[model samples]
Target chain A: MKKKWLIGVLLMVLVMSVSGCKKDDQVVLNVYNWGDYIDESIFDTFEEETGIKVNYETYATNEEMYTKIKNGGSNYDIAIPSDYMIEKMIKEDMLEPLNMDSIPNFANIDDQFKDLAFDPQNKYSIPYFWGTVGIIYNTDLIEEEIDSWDALWNPKYAGMFTMVDSQRDSIMVALKKLGYSMNTKSVAELEEAKALLIEQKPLVLAYVGDNVKDMLISGEAAMAVVWSGEASTVIQEYDNFKYALPKEGSNKWFDNIVIPKGSEHVAEAHQFIDFLCRGDIGFLNADYVGYATCNTETMELLDPALMGTTYAYPDKALLENFEVFLDPGDFISEYDRVWTEIKAN
Target chain B: MLKKLSSGPYWLWSFIFIVVPIMLIIAFSFSVPGEAFKFSLDNYKRFMEPVYLKVLARSVKIAVEATLICLAVGYPMAMILARMHLKYRTIAVMLLVVPMWMNFLLRTYAWMTILNKNGILNHILSFFGLPQMTFLYSEGAVLLGMVYNFLPFMVLPIYTVLTKMDNSLIEAAEDLGANRRTVFRKVTFPLSLPGVLSGVSMVFMPAVSTFVISDLLYGGQYMLVGNLIQQQFLVVNDWHFGSAISMLLMVMILITMSIMNRLGQDGVEQGGGNIW
Candidate 1:
């Protein structure tokens, strides 16, 4: 009699637990993005309005994201990779073509961001944030107006400046100062760039990565080669610092979101992407992350103070002089060797 | 047989985590990437370049310097701690270990705060009317980071050996009319050689292969072999080259360990069962 009663209780518990799980299980969309790239509050709002769940994860660099996706260990519904990585993924068929009918807010994207060199047809990726490389200077230390890349090579600023310790960005600066294309593949052009960098090495206080902000804001270095977003972010905190677009031109890079091939919830992913594209939503994210939004509608929604800043949104004429970094393909080895030689010095 | 069967989980864990990964690395080291997993020597050939050789030599030099500094500092502290009363010995060991409980990166970054040009160290120096110093982002800073972080590893092992040492040996040497210096040189030092060897190896391995310490404290100006491997794998997307470097590093470490082991064995033979 006792055993029969225990069996009845067990069955009741199992049925109740199953029903509980069914009620709480919502459409889950997995998102992979750059570390600290988005406004996290947006996720909470989306979950409340749409009754969907978000599984958000972040990677430090594009190469790390590519390796994880290629391994197929995780089922990520959406991934945000940089321009060159998006090109590589599209070429390798690791991404799914977007269904535009589901994303009507796609119209908000500026025409300049459309038909990009990485995804010319706009079939695979959506532009998220775009920015150009420029020099950030400390005004208190330098009385002169900084307008050109040559300021970095000034002997007077020796041992008082930092350069971005990235192979492409650093090499691009040298190439541009010499009046050559930032994407030059010629051996002589690259060698000249490497020699120029070696000449300027003594003047550099350090070759740093993301720590350039702290180094500059604290007056440890008089100048740094930094991205436009970092300049805007630091400008809000320190008034002594200012950003400049060099007359010699620089690399304009973009980060975009795309769906990897192995995702399970494609429709849910589309909904999330569309939700992010709303004008207000885009403005909140751009303001929070301090990056230039590619959304034309978002620009209209932004305050005049934000729209007026050239660091946040540079003039169109200056952008025309910028070049995007292309995938170097097999010649990437040459770039690697050149960078190693410089660091080894 | 039943007791041996209980160790199955450990064997499985080792095979999955250690043995398999090592095999994969060795296989990848010999092949060209983007092709079949067939054999090729090109990857290894690339590491024979003068640039890579220089990086490897510098890594060894830094590791050795850090290890030697740890030994010089740790030996005296360990000895004093071992000689302390039971209550105080516990407190001393705890103090040495407390810094390690915090994240290593946090500790290294703290050094950055103290050593930067306008940092706390300079502030104190300038307050005294002394010249401000550029101490951060230099080789000395990197060495300081390595020694500060790895000092505990060097201390604990020697402390353990000193504590376990038989007290009668020192008394025996004393009764034979040997002075204090002679007792330590002949009795204490030889018996403690095993701990010293292990401690040296422990500190040397991590110091030799560290990229973060140099990258942060020296500002990426000093690229060790570990940084070279990291650059190839993550930035250059050349897994073949990275694997080759890993294999070379492993062989170099293996040779180092064997030499150290031989020295330890010689100490044991010379001590003639003096160590417990």
Candidate 2:
């Protein structure tokens, strides 16, 4: 019996290694980008047309993605990072200049999204989707009309309001309320922003990340300072939920697709990017997600009602009052430190 | 024949499930992931931050407190069970074991349902003309969850020891004109120390590292060492830093286990006499 058991054990170990090994020979496109921000079926279409097997990857935050790419994630063929992150990546020399000549369908891009601060000549990043930060409120809960960033901290809405759980975002809102720059490098301005946040913390329901949409939807909090894309999704789900980019200045955050320095399958990636830029495909993604689109053709193809929704796409006056977050060199480390201190306290 | 048949299956399963993965983690612990999986030392200094150290210390402190509470609460309950009539003892044991049959995460969440500001506990308090209470998102909730989850482990071990205890020895003490207290101190307690050690090991090991309870009840406000490791892997994508921190935690656990082993062997050398 003992000898038989020993034989069985050896057989099992032999079988185990056989099962554990992977030998996938599929043409792999390792695409890493923001989670829940893309339609994965697009990969299936790409695969069906071109037999390149797509390996879909996701990152929750830009910093998290930055860390991966830094640690030799040259394995990834493409990544979508925000405009500021794209700027930081370019400065760090981590991106490849998009051979725009290879991508003729790039003419599909809207002029407004072109020539932004990150890539002045639009050399590196291909703008994927764009939106502004804003307040999402339950119209049933708030008695007064909400217009400005200060309305979030108003004692009248105390304990009923929630700001974004993110460090840069929440601090930016406080900074904007104080009429300071969203990209302020001044330590004095940052300190004042920090103090205002600490004071406002008592009024906060919680500082959370992706849970902002759920929190507002569940009626746990009356308002959440959230990405306009997520706010639009919520307003779509429940008609009573209202969204407003603060009457004061708001930050416009845009995400763009950039090929990293060591991407192996650039041509296929460009083809995939072109496929995404198609009017119907772009409209499908934007219609379900509710983020304003950078694809001019997608906007023209969207339902007139969806296009006209104020929360989905705010007017020009509101757009002018907004600022873009800049990659403020060494100030970011300080920004991170201040954010950590605020969270700690 | 029987030994051969059983031995092969056990060794095979253990090797496949336990030995190989542990070896992999230890290997990965040394090699930091670089571009194209190139090795580097850049990940090792990641946990030097004060934030991570505080969290590790907090985990250790909370685990120790939970283990101690389990010891104090479980030993007496187990003793009473071991002394009960057989039929009643079976019923009591069933009752004690039933809570374990439920899902641990589900049970922890139930505590949240009862303890949140608008939860059952607060509603009861308000009904009694007392003010409403906020019990969720506090350290007390975390400790409570830990104890509730681990109490079964504490009680079962000590019960095993107490049930195996020789009643003949107790009678012998009584015959020598010794009181119950003296008998217990001299005989009963020493016999159960091994069970106490086992119980402590089970509760202490898990409580020190578990992150789910804190996340669910405490709003994940405070980071423990476990949380740091999770954030590195899931959120930060800093595997090298994560590996370095994991190596530190492994060393900490090893040092603790070595001391425990030495003390445990000393216990054997002393004939298990110093139970109290």
lDDT of each: 0.89, 0.78
- For candidate 1, lDDT tens digit of each residue in B159-218? 888898899999999999999999999999989988898889889999999999999998
- Candidate 1 structure quality by residue, lDDT tens digits, A295-316: 9989998876876565888877
Clashes of 2: 9
Against the true structure, candidate 1 reaches a TM-score of: 0.95
Instruction: Give the TM-score of chain A, superposed on the true chain A, for all candidates in the order listed.
Output: 0.91, 0.91
lDDT of 2 at A285: 77
Docking class of 2: incorrect
Candidate 2 lDDT, A68-162, residue by residue in tens: 89769457888999988899899989998887877776889899889998888888988889888888889998867777888766778866766
Best candidate per TM-score, number?
A: 1
Q: Which portion of correct inter-chain contacts appears in model 2? A: 0.07
Q: Runs in model 2 with CA error above 4 Å?
A: A1-26, A156-158, A308-310, A328-331, B1-64, B73-133, B148-185, B201-212, B223-276
Evaluated with DockQ, which candidate comes out highest?
1
